[model samples]
Target: MRFWMVFAWLSSALLLAVAQETVLTDDALHKPITVWQRLASLAEVLDDIRKQTGVPLRCQDALREMKLAVYVQNRPAREILEQVASLFGLRWRRDDDGSYVLYLPDETRRALERAQRDDRAATERALREMLRIAREWLRLPPEARAEAMAPFAQTREYPANMPYSAYLMEEAAAQRQMTQEQRVKALVADYLSGYSPQGEPSKPKRDAFFSEEDTQGSLLHCLSEAGDAIVNRLLEGHTLGFSTRPTPDALPLPPRVLLPFWMRHAQLSDESVLQFDAASGQFTEVQPLPNPDWGGYWVRLSAWGNSLEYMVVALRVYELDGKTQKFLNKVDYQLHLPHQEYLAETETWRQWEAWATPMEDWTARLKERTPLERPKPTVNNERPLLAADALEWLAWHTGYPVISDASRYVPAWYRDSLDSPRALLTLLSNDLWLRFDPNGYLLARHKRFWTLNQFEIPERIVRPLEAKWLAWQWLSLDDYATLAAAITDEQARGFTRVRRRGSIQFWTAFDNDPLYYELPALRFWASLSAAQRQRALAGEWIPESALTLPQRKLFRAALYREFPPPEQLLRDLPDDYEVGLYVPSVFRSEGVPESRSEALKQSPDAPAFRVLQQNPVSELSVLKYKDELGRRTYTLHEVKTQVSREGVDWKKVFQEAGYEGEPAEAILKTVLDTILQFALPPRMFEQYILNQSRYADFGRHAAP
Candidate 1:
């Protein structure tokens, strides 16, 4: 019987499962299991109603399993089913038997949707309120409102119920001591009039909205104004009013508001700005004041043992006319250094290294005392004198050559000029005589070389004694004195006793003449018979018949062509002899000589009638002679004399050649030939002569 019962139960479970599947219809199968599936299957109807409408309803899991009648609310079943499907995770689908299948859960789906919707609405309302508050704040004047409201503007959120105006008023009151009504008026005035340090204007006709006078109604206002005046006076005193500090705080009782205003302007909010009274150098009583347009102002005060050390005061005031806001900042600083303290500090660092020591001590001392009262300027007496080794070290460090001229020397006048023993020591230490004594003495005596002009002294000496004498010159004097002081024998003559040569000037003459000669014999030799020329070329056959005086001279001239005389020999030779030899043709007159009276008459200075009558010798010719074999070689010289050419005149030629056109005509050519003779090489001499012709042609063309 137990076996039968177990089998029967399993069969029942399987049947019920099949019935559930068969109940779904073909239409339900065609449709998807979606939010609207509940309306297509009655079994899911009540579950769907609860979910979709947020209403609790009865559900029958056993009836659903058995495929019995499914109950639902009286509301439109389709609507209820749709709502249930949407609210809860339920759906419908068609089964193989053409029956609809409904899936449902226990919870009310519609109630959850309602709660979510309400939450979303409330959030949205809060966001709207926040946005409204921000808009209101933005509409408020920037000068009247605080910067705290800026974050709200960025997020655009506000409290849901509070009025925007009321919020703004609260913010203003917190930042500034002002009532609600007063805040509105002030912000409105600030918005319309822009930043106005003075109170808002009563009448709107004129653009002027406010003045400082209008803001004087409040106690803070009076205090701030009074503080401003006092700080201004302090700044003036520190800078322009007087160099000295006042005896006491002369202004009226410190303005309560002004103290905060000054502190704010100075940026003394940090604790670092203030210090203990015993600290002496510490600042105290730091505070900051609010500025309408530009943040706040800061100020601070510091004391130095028994006296106020320093005070910084400032205020941010808006200038309406200039349309600018500026911090009128001022500082009062006083340094009080007791004499004993200063002396102690000075002694502590008296021997300190020059490079590492602070300049504060030196600068302070300079400011505190007059020049007369201060210690005289002194070179560090303890500094070791620069010996040769020291100097070598310095030279190595500086990378410059130390020359002999930088030797030690002292002048008698230097000894007389010393004002004190310390000064004298400095003079002696720097004196080349003491510093470079042995070396300077040895160089002066043995080398006979002074460092005066050749060697430059190091800057140490050059900067001081550079005006009158050189380093070596001074060195010589110092060494002489030092040597004299050390010498045991009074009779021993010092280096100074040695007479020195004074500077002297001398004159000399320079000779720069070139030798010149003709080569007529060489030319004649070329003209000889080839057999005769060959015989001449051969040493065996010689011209036994001695040459005539003129021929011998010509031969000598030919020898000169091969080998010219030295310039000294040429300069010693008679000028006339040189001219007659190589330059004979240059001196020959190209034209026949005319009487001076006739020449003058034909000159340009002559009367026009006399010029017309005179033939004005336009052409000239000359005969040139040279010594040859027992005969004179003659050559005809022709010169085409230009009378007044169309474009050029004799005056133009003289001017173009940079000549004054002196009467001594041959002298000019002689000088020019002399210069060219030595300046040009033998190969270039002919080219130079040819170039002269080219120059003449250029001059002729250019003449006007």
Candidate 2:
């Protein structure tokens, strides 16, 4: 794995070296500048502009003689260009290749006319193709073709430089084009209006619709307005496509009707999500103002304790129309520690484990009880009887070297037998008061040492999940000094908070900073050659701390991958390192419990479990297309099924997102069927006679 990673990095570097040379002029243009300067003619001023702002400016040859003299303070490249255009009675526009060009009034007008002519020509070509396809395939007469095309006949042009697939879709189906046009408008209106298809007002929007708390309405309302402002700015009057719809449905709904939706959805219907009675936290239900047209969501949270610090939150999201009650997914998150009662229960568990017979004692007792000769381990025979022994045992088994801030200690007498490797590790940790991290290390410290620095969050808990596990283990810090001590520089020390992009009321951390802090180090480390990394890890070159924090982290990670701890590498290795060969597997004398039900016992066919066992589909084919803004995305193009009783008879085509991750293949098949149920073309939907003599009509496949 390390070898391949280095190769990939070298390959990428080689590709970058061979790619097109950067244009010096283009780079100079977008660079920002602050300067105090004077300009002469437009040409000279443009030169000055380029020199100061690094913005390449080109003046029309016809306007080369135009003069402009002005003193300017610090201003951006764009602002300088605007001022120049205004002074010379000229205008500037970006070319298709992104270069900026200036033009006089008459020249600009003529350019616009030419663009319009070109647009009309493109539209006429598409229309001709559409008519020809309709005539050949749909058997549409001239009159019928005109009638079918009437809705899109009003000087409608496609987005400039359209992809071939979009052009094909436009020429193939009039209905699809009409539906897409309507869908985009509907999505925009639903996002802005906060109402469902059934004309029900969204709950969150109504509740915070007029909030004065952040001087912005509720969080959802603020978000909606921010999004609207951006869209409005981008939405200039266009000659292509249909004119914008100015209907009542597109307007924002009044507060009175909307407030009730928020009131209704805000109530917690799931007792599991709420009703957690804890001394530190109270349950709060938050209904996200529904975007009825786009989707809607609600969140339930338990915020307990003083200042409502500890929390457990559950979120539910709706897909399609909310009125239909179709939901996409739900997720639960833990953000803080459990209350006192939970901690007390855990203490009780530890005490009970201390009373149970330790595994070493049990094995010793078994040997004494039997007189027969027992098999002995071929490699290391000694068990992990001490703290150092346990560390060596872990190093050999987990394949990563262990680093410790721990001292050697006498073995504990109360280690209980556990079933799995993880369970055994947990027992050792609880019984011995030690910390084992799979990132490749173990720490043994006194009880007080663990309690003193509680704020340090483990890398695992810092993940998308509540980082709650770290909180539970550590007590809350009352002041900044204590908080600072708990956090290592390797851990995230701070977050730069920013208001949610479209909303003024809600706030979110700057995502890129945290991502940068974590990703760059790992990525750079993965890109290095293994030999170089080995040298660094072995201390053959610079000291570990000499490098930056990211580099240190990555270097340690690579070392953990290839080398075991120093103690374990010595000759005449300790017996505990090979203890795995000495350990014996024991089965319960009472025999394994039967958990399967009668139905499963009889046929071994529990429907849900059977679906999981079957690999229904593995690969999903997709088509990549660009939206109006030229952003590319992959959508489902086809779904092929494995052979079953259906004999692999069905093949479906649709444009929608496909499932990923751990969902069962059956669920994916269902989702594909749903999309195709709505997307199949009209002609393709009808039953066809496969064998006329036998009168066998093959209908479309049954709905999943």
Candidate 3:
């Protein structure tokens, strides 16, 4: 009220001032300045302007203190002031009393308003998505809603009818304090104006909408006009209000992620995603993003206590697409830590463990009873555990190396839910023939490994619906000899070798891959004498048809190749050095990968890029690609490295981050929430089908 009163008083004074303007005729503002200062403070120059023009300047002390350089050789006082104000990031308006008032620029004042508008638009888009979900929920039977909305809400209850207009009406009555007639007008006005935000597909000036504006009795006209005075956007003539008709009837469903959404504390809604990955610090992706044209989402979260300033999890959401996971959008969210209350974790990176819900109430009774005196793990509250994780937890307690892809290698434990860890271990040893190698690595000859395939480990999750004991077991020569200790070395070696178990082996075998000069091409080059080299360059070896014109020229110019190698290129280097050679696996650049096999996906050794040897860890080698006839060829460079590892000041890191020790799981969840994949319950959605027309819209792969 006080603000309005002050505004009205100023407005009245402006009217009275205008009445006096006719006689006063403030012509000094239009007058030119006399001097040009190279560097002048606003306070000094503006005062000079006031003195010369006899026009008083009204501005804040901060604005007055702003200094700028100007070359204003006899310019109007008003023009000078305008240029000065612009340079200082300020704006000026003529006051009612014929004085100039300096204020902030337009965007600076409306920054918060623009952010709010964006947030509102994102929320509206997500709400439209929910309304569609509600329609689908209504279509589903009562029994199905629970399952369908399990990713979204805790409850199955929802309005039977459309809720958009009802919400608008509620906003009108409760917030707007609109009368019944105005409320009806709002709905009626929406119907007449078609739903297009840009107001494209203009109505054909019909009787139902004779003109663009319903100017005869407009309620929002004054409001929009008032807003226009502040920001020019509200008065846009092209505002196609939303459609009164319902959202589209048919909808494709979202992909079911491999996340464990069923949790004790965290709840993932259909619109809101909360992912958790504590195992691998690196982010993992879940495939098949939603189809296009579905609106994206924006979320605002409340504080999880006084939040710890942490890292931002950048989520790169792509189209649930096989066509290169077409880059769609990105969202970043802070990780939350709610460890005080019984914290929950996202089953996003769940292990395929068997009935492995931690027996939180468990004591060291098993350790007390058994001979294996391994470390006793901290007992936690009992909750559901993924099968793969259960096996790993038991392994952690017993100090066992986790079997690679244990979920696929040992498929039985997923179904066989044992109550105790001993029962699980007992099941493994007695039924699956579990045994460790001399070095403590799990042996590969177990029944579990043989169940899938005898020649190779099957590259798939071989989940048999029913347990089939020794289903694929067969007697191999090794297996047969294992049952008979009397079997001689000759019998064990496929019955070919004589009984020479005590004989000393005279063979020395070594791999030549790391030996730089041992390449076959180099050997061929060395085998050639000078005359042979001359003949070879003259096309004696490698027919002219096989050699391109450029290749022949290169061979002639390069003297057919150097035999026994040239002098050292690194002769300038110091002699005191540590060097050796190690070769890592070379992988094809997947270029976002077409599709990876299950074996390759689960194999740790087959990373897209990895250093097999750690001591000489360096990416200093260059991969040189050569064009050849019907084959890819490369010359590899090898180097060995030895470097001391640097120690990190983790205490300083935690201190700088405002943490006493390790932060809560909520913090991790906050980071994961940024990623939208919510696959849980060990259920996966339909995989993305690679088709001929995958990138039809992207113009990469043309339509089939």
Candidate 4:
């Protein structure tokens, strides 16, 4: 029997029920710290923190070897934990001990008791779906089963149309784009006689060990699910089968070789059933396997929004043998799949450091054309209306969901009528680009961002580039009981990590945009003097640095609490799935743009004074994209859009509306006659992130 056959048997036989328990610790997750780490492996970063902070950060066997990039000057440990966890949609827990006790959220663990019945009920559907597929297979007659299995037996063609990953195309796009026909030919030729390999495959045993006494070097203890291949394979093969049992060993085994327990006689085979009968492991010494041939490619994503200059540092690929539930270590079978060795640029993720809509034309249209009553944005307070409130108000009235950046919108009275979805969206877009990035975001780019071999934009075109951001918002719940319950559990013991006033919480969605209405950093920034604001733009921020942590918290709560948070435009999502905020990235930046605050020449590291990009296309239609499971990523999802048609001096509007400070006019300007901006502020985000990081990154940027 083939070795792969045994894998099916093990998967079915070992139906291990993984049960986990967690105890609550005081709150080290919120431990504020100062650190700067660029491209590094997941283990190194976690270990370094443990060594420095004396608090151990850990991961499971599968993920220990993964590499990730993180650059944060000053942030809470919870953010770090959640950021990493969300990357793979992994669950986590915060235990009573200072160490990481589990891989689920503390909030999730606490809610377990209260939501045990509910969560159990919720997960039953997936199990039932699995059963349904198994039943379908079982119902077929033996002939039909053979027919179903025929596809596996049929010879496959390798080096078919290869799907290029962002990393692989980095250099290709730079060398010069080939014509479609020429490109296809080149892609095919890249896989040299791929379908007909001429080498014997390496057969690494499951345990990579012989009998107990036959001691040799240890094999790989853990393998990182690093590239696009691993993630795609897991998601694509999520449903498990109720497979058949293994066949009997053989007809004529060793007749009767009975031996005493002390004298166990056996053939010295170089294989073991257990993982070297696992005990302690030394992961650092685990060597990398050579490479593997591609079974097929995940051609799901296209090279649209990402800047083509994304460099591929390493190219690694692995094929998951479903029958064996193991990655074929380094078997080069000539079959090809362009699974890049780096992070797959997916779900509006253009690349590691940048995102954008393709240059192709797209007119914005609502998926749901049913008439929605146009509701004017109104708040409890008598102050001017904010852009976030408008989004929340529109989302509340209409069921459309919006993803926004953390950029702050200057507050001003909206005398314009929001009688139509287009009108309302156009008004909200202001100077920013209201693009359908498959999802809508208030996005824009300044000439200053593009770079390198590709986008070889001449120095002239690149120099005057403006800085911009596409802003979505954090999810919030108000006036809706269903959404409210989703954000928090009164039964849980730990303090909520979100902003709150009585029952209502702010920025519950991981995206930071919703915080604007909750905390208008722009309004506060505008209230400051001109000289202080300009100095902040020049990269030299001037703010009171000596405020205690408690004082800063009190000030943040008192000044911004009354304002509303952004309502998650969509209906509340199911548990374990929250709206994750993707901070903007750049095509040619060194690392994460938000992490590097030293870009004073292009734009200040403030919320408001960022990028402003929009292009009016001819038509609007949703991209027909699907997930690995072939499910539509967005079901019954629709968007409503409007572009900035005219200019409005947002700063003037603020001044007239009773603000005590000056406008941040330099951040955005009327560069074109028809083009316009609302005079947003980098001053306050500079104010906002500063007030928070002032104490953290203080020693470096201290006032003279």
In order, candidate lDDTs are: 0.26, 0.29, 0.28, 0.27
- Give the CA lDDT, 0 to 100, for residue 692 in model 1: 9
Where is model 3 poorest over a 10-residue stretch in terms of lDDT?
669-678
Q: Write the per-residue lDDT of candidate 3 for residues 222-325, one digit (tens) a residue.
A: 12222222112211211111111112321111221111111111111222232235443212122212212222111111111111111111112233335323
Candidate 3 ranges with C-alpha deviation above 4 Å: 1-30, 34-48, 51-55, 60-75, 78-704
Model 1 agreement with the true structure over 62-175: per-residue lDDT tens digits: 224111111121224333333333222345444455333455534323433443344333333322332233334434454434353322221223564444334543453453
In model 2, what lDDT does residue 387 have? 34
Instruction: Name the runs in model 1 displaced over 4 angstroms.
Output: 1-88, 91-108, 135-140, 144-146, 152-704
Q: Assess candidate 4 and give its TM-score to the true structure.
A: 0.19
lDDT of 4 by residue, 1-704 (tens): 43343353233222211111122233665676543332234556677656655666676654453333343334565545544453323455444554563253443334334333332232232223322332343345545644543432323233322322222233334323444323322322331111111122221232232211111000000001122332243333221110011112101111111111111112113123223323332011022122221111111111111111000011122133443221111110011122210112221112212333332332234445433344333553312243444554444344443322211222312434333455455444432233443322222321111110111112211112211111221111111112222222221111111212211112221222222221333333333345544454454433333234543343343222221111111122122221111122122122213311223223433322322222221111122355443333311211122122243344443343344554222111111001101111231122122110001110122111
TM-score on alpha carbons, each prediction:
0.12, 0.17, 0.17, 0.19
Q: What is the Å distance of residue 441 in model 1 from its true position?
A: 99
**Residue-pair clashes per candidate, as listed?**
52, 13, 25, 46
Q: Write the per-residue lDDT of candidate 2 for residues 1-704, one digit (tens) a residue.
A: 54454455344433432321222235454455432221134565567676675555676885553423233333345544543443223566666666567776674345335433443333333223322332232233434533544443334468755643344345435433445434322222232232321232222232232222111112223223223332222122111110011122122332311221222332234333233335433332233333222111111111111000111111122233444232111111111111221222233233323323354443332232211122211222112233334443443334322322222122322222211233334334532343332222232332211221222232222222223212222111111112222344433212101111111111111112222122222333343345644543342323343456665554444332211221221222222211011011121111211211212232222111000011123223232455455544533322444223233332231212244422112211211000000001111110100100000012321110
Error of 4 at 207 (Å): 47
Top candidate (lDDT): 2
Per-residue error at 547 for model 1, in Å? 99
Q: Which residue runs does candidate 4 get wrong by more than 4 Å?
A: 1-26, 38-41, 51-56, 95-98, 102-182, 186-704
lDDT of 4: 0.27
Q: What is the C-alpha RMSD of each candidate to the true structure, in Å?
A: 53.9, 35.1, 39.8, 28.8
